[model samples]
Target: MRCFVTGAAGFIGSNLVDRLLAAGHEVVGYDNFSTGQRSFLEGAGRSAGFTLVEGDLLNPDVLRPAVAGCDIVFHLAANADVRFGTHHPFKDIEQNLIATFNVLEAMRAHGIKKIAFSSTGSVYGEAAVIPTPEDAPFPIQTSLYGNSKVAAEGLISSYCEGFGFQGFIFRFVSILGERYTHGHVFDFYNKLRNDPSSLEVLGNGKQRKSYLYVQDCIDAILIAVERADAKINIFNLGQNEYCEVNQSIGWICDRLGVSPKLSYTGGERGWIGDNPLIFLDCSRIRALGWTPKLSIRDGVVNTLEYLMANPWVLDARG
Candidate 1:
């Protein structure tokens, strides 16, 4: 198979690139390196089957040609700054929503019939339902990042219906594993390293969240692409259970062998678009015989270990 993956130098995209190459598939990687790290693609660069293209999705002239002759499109690139969406209101619209439209157009022009998108569980906002299902009704959107993803999902579905394309949209919980650059784990680790004596936490630190390991996430995506053939196939990729923010903090602190004084920002949400709880009912993906191996605690610990080993990522992100 020939696969074209956007955000190929990013956390999940780089992992997926290596996985595809290991499975004997040819991959064309696309990224502009805004938040992506070239160091993450070190392994993929050694593969004869992997080709990296430095380009932006907003530029169709470059993106269209780069996507030519691809069997499938994995659209994983986006502005993931969910915490600061209000800072730059148009960042999500330009980078996520508009960029997704460009990818679809490029696919359409090249007659590419299949696409897999990285949607987020954030789209559910503060849902009334616990362990939110794929079919759960969406509440009013709280963040620009989630709003853009919801709109992108709609665009992909429409393309599938009108152009006979197959779309696989995976709504993921907070993903963790090797090569993790951003997110709560990274933030906490960075803070602890600087000041081992104390750590300032956002909100009340009781926000319940579910997380899936990166490899597990890639496995679920590949399985769905191979077995599920629907016009628009949507799946929630996450662990069945969740952990509190405070629980994750404990794991990180334990691993680092440091007990930091904790201070709270005093709110349920860490940011404007932050959801206090996000536990996805992944029965849809589980029905396809896929289950994540790592628990939320394991995921958090592993992420911290990776960051500890590769302290360069901290500098790169900064």
Candidate 2:
């Protein structure tokens, strides 16, 4: 199969590219290098079956050409700066929502019917249900990034129903692993690197959330895309278990061997629109013979190892 992955140079996208290549699929990567790093694609660039399209999806000229002649589209590119959603309000709409609309339109024009969209658990908006399922009702949206993803998912569902497209919507928790440039793990690592004596944590450090290893995330995506045949397939991709922010901080500190003095930023939530807790019920995907293999602590430890090995990522990403 010919696969086109947007945000192809990103952490998860790059990992997925390698998996697809190993599976003997021809892959085309589309990335603008805004948040994604070129270093992530260093290995994929060497594959004869991999082609890189350097352009932004906001531009139809570039988006249309990049998605052309693709069998399946893995739409993962988006502005993931959820914490600073209010600082730049319209970025989420343009980069995430509008880009998705453009992709759907391009797919419609080119007769591509299958798309695997990278949505998020943030869309649940402080969901009342713990271990939230795919069919869980949505509460109020907590952040602009979550709001945009909700709109994107709706658009994809509409496209599937109206245009005979097959949609695979994956609501993922935070992902951690190699090439992880952003998120709490990266933030903590950078902080400890500068001041090993003490670490300041966001929120009360009690915000519990689930996380998945990048490989497990891609595994669920592949299983759903290849096996699930529903017109609109929605799956929650995450570990069955969850953990508190402070708990994860402890594991990270242990690995770094820094017992930093812990200071609270004084809030139940980390930032505006940040859900203090997110425990996804991944049974929907687990039924499809998929299960996360990494614990929260293991994922954190692995991510720390990656950051330690690549000390330059912090400066390069920031």
Best by lDDT: 1
TM-score of each: 0.99, 0.99
lDDT of the candidates, in the order given: 0.94, 0.92
Candidate 2 Cα misplacement greater than 4 A, ranges: none
TM-score (C-alpha) between model 2 and the true structure: 0.99
Ten-residue stretch with the least lDDT total in model 2: 250-259
Candidate 1 lDDT tens digits, 2-104: 9999999999999999999999999999999999999889989999999999999988989999999999999999998888899998999999899999999
lDDT of 2 at 217: 94
TM-score of 1: 0.99
